[model samples]
Target: MSNADLPSHCDVLVVGAGPAGAACALWLARAGVDVVLVDQHDFPRDKVCGDGLIPDAHHALRRLGVYDEVMAAAEASRHVACIGPRGGRIDVPGTVAVLPRRELDDIVCRAAVRAGAKLRTPWRFEAAVVEGDVVVGARLKQGDVVRETRARWVVLATGAVPQALQAADMCKRRTPSGIALRGYVKNDAMVGRIKALEVVWHKSLTPGYGWIFPAPGGRFNIGVGIAHSHPARDGEPAKMKDVNLRKVFEAFCAHYEPARELMRTGTLEGDLKGAPLRCSLAGARYSRPGLLVTGEAAGSTYSFTGEGIGKAYETGLLAAETLLAAPGGVPAGTADDVRTRYEAALAALQPRFDLYERANRVNAHPWLADLLIWRARKSERLLRRMAGVLEETSNPGNLVSVRGIVRVLFPGA
Candidate 1:
């Protein structure tokens, strides 16, 4: 269709076809709204992620009607293991699914298409075309072809790249910074024998941790992320550019006798991509006329484990529901009313997540790490309880409340 003769305008315009955007589109389209989903990258694009989806994330996919497809296409792991110094280990009985972002993105995007959302890959959002402080639509460019796509509302699912929504001016820094690095490698025999995802806490990498998530077909997603405000930052800080995760990878390989075989012919696919762990604790603003930000764009990522897929999924659904409710479209500042609904939902039962987020920001002593690891190893019940809290099925808030009371009474609990 010609730019002027654009076949149809949608009730909602979703920019960026990542998990958050695609999930929003899928939900809206299923509600029978005319939804347009666009992205700068084509189908099957790769994203840098830890690649493990907690059980609640699976529940989210079930809501979006892609759970079956996700199960079929992605690899699955049933638990997460914490490995500590001196080979102390703990296995928490939980289920986490895995998929390479390339395959998973394609599956979810296709699911949205199946639900009746128009998918436009390789379409770049140029700017928000506004009228009297209202976001009416967006100017889009595809391979030098400039055009316009108008909708009643616009949703930003653009992940960590915040420049796209600068026009909306509704975003703020929740945290000072976020940093991470991840890559894929062949799952060697040792990893194969150990069937759960492993999180290693080494004294040397305080305030940071390393992880090993096994994928289907004998492959693994392994990486580490550290809070940027470490005492180690003084002399020569390791910027995302300087960290050389590959060097870290080699160093990790040197320490793990079991991982040596896997590193023999290791190849780094792409440089590590960084995304901020935007918090809602300090409260960042969201939503404005003609524009609403979801996923990483809104900084909905959890501040603790740096896991955002679940938060992104929840916000994506909320963003769509809010748009549907606001037939007249989103309004500036007042957007918080809609945004608060989702935030409250997350906060009501997610206080432990917030507490963990606070803990992550604090300088983690090796003794604490050792204690946590020891706790994990000592009792499977505690590990399961902690994992349940992580999964969000159990009440993290209630758990935190009890802990707070205990600390108040004992002072060293």
Candidate 2:
């Protein structure tokens, strides 16, 4: 659509029609709020991600009333197999699903539109329109024309795009926490052989891991992620910026016999893509006057596993709930109330974020991860507990506690 055709005002203007923005709009529109959801790209756009949905993501989809659709379109797996650095393997049974972002995102965004949210595509967010320290709306560029969208509130769900946050003066940190690369490969033989999601912790990829997730139609989503701030083994200065993620991923495939064999007969479906990740543990602010941030823009991605879909959906719901609960429409001074409530809701998730941060530290140590996997392999109780962690049914803190450590060390007890 042309910039001239865009709406001049709305009750809420949501930038980015991804999961977060879509969910927020879905809930708001369902509540009879006038919401405009905008994105640079249209439906069925691919996003660089592992594309695996854990149980938490399933719950989020259910809450959004789209779980049935996602499940019907996704590949369901009840097991997660992990290969530690020392080659020790552990398999935990749980509920997980994988669906390409192209389809998953389209489903959610369509739901938002069906629920009466206005969706504008190819709308590039340029900057926030502020008046006296309050964001009254946003300026957007479409093609050669620039347009302004006035709204009572604005939501920034633009994923990890730093320019938007930086322009709004909301970005708390300049450096990204980590980076990840992903691509799809078609291999019927490999897909048939691997019924469960697989994660490998190679010693070379400290503080990061590799994954193979089953996608629809005999395809696999393969990827690797590493912390940008991870230290070099020899104590030399880390040249993270100089590192080539593609080369690293190639090395990973070459080193792992299974991955190598799988890729040997498989054809690459697309060029490998990479993206930066910001973790919620970084403590980035989620809201400011007349504006709120959700998804990766708010640092909602988990620090340890790089799992953002579930958290993104969650923050979207919370943002919508906060706005819907306000007695009247948001006024200039009332922005603070919205900010306070959103921050408090985010605070409730801090424990999980802290646990994931601690787990990331454990992941850095190859031997520690190997030992834990080794023990879990021999004990059904421990295995079940580990599965619970993946399903998010059990607290991650239990796996790191002294008592929990003792139980794992002596499973017979």
| lDDT scores in order | 0.67, 0.83
* Residue 7 CA displacement from its true place in model 2, Å: 0.6
lDDT value, residue 230 of candidate 1: 24
- lDDT of candidate 1 over 80-166, digit per residue (tens): 776765577767667688887888778888888889988876778888878887777888877878788887778878777656755
Off by over 4 Å in 2: 1-4, 228-242, 281-283, 329-333, 397-406, 411-413
- Per-residue lDDT of candidate 2, residues 29-145 (tens digit): 998889999998867789998898988889999999999999999999988888888788887888888999999999999999899988887888899999998899999887887
TM per prediction: 0.83, 0.93
Superposed by TM-score, candidate 2 places the C-alpha of residue 405 at a distance from the truth, in angstroms, of: 4.0
The Cα error of candidate 2 at residue 106, in Å, is 0.3
- Alpha-carbon deviation at 367 in model 1, angstroms: 3.0
Model 2 deviation from native, Cα RMSD in Å: 2.9
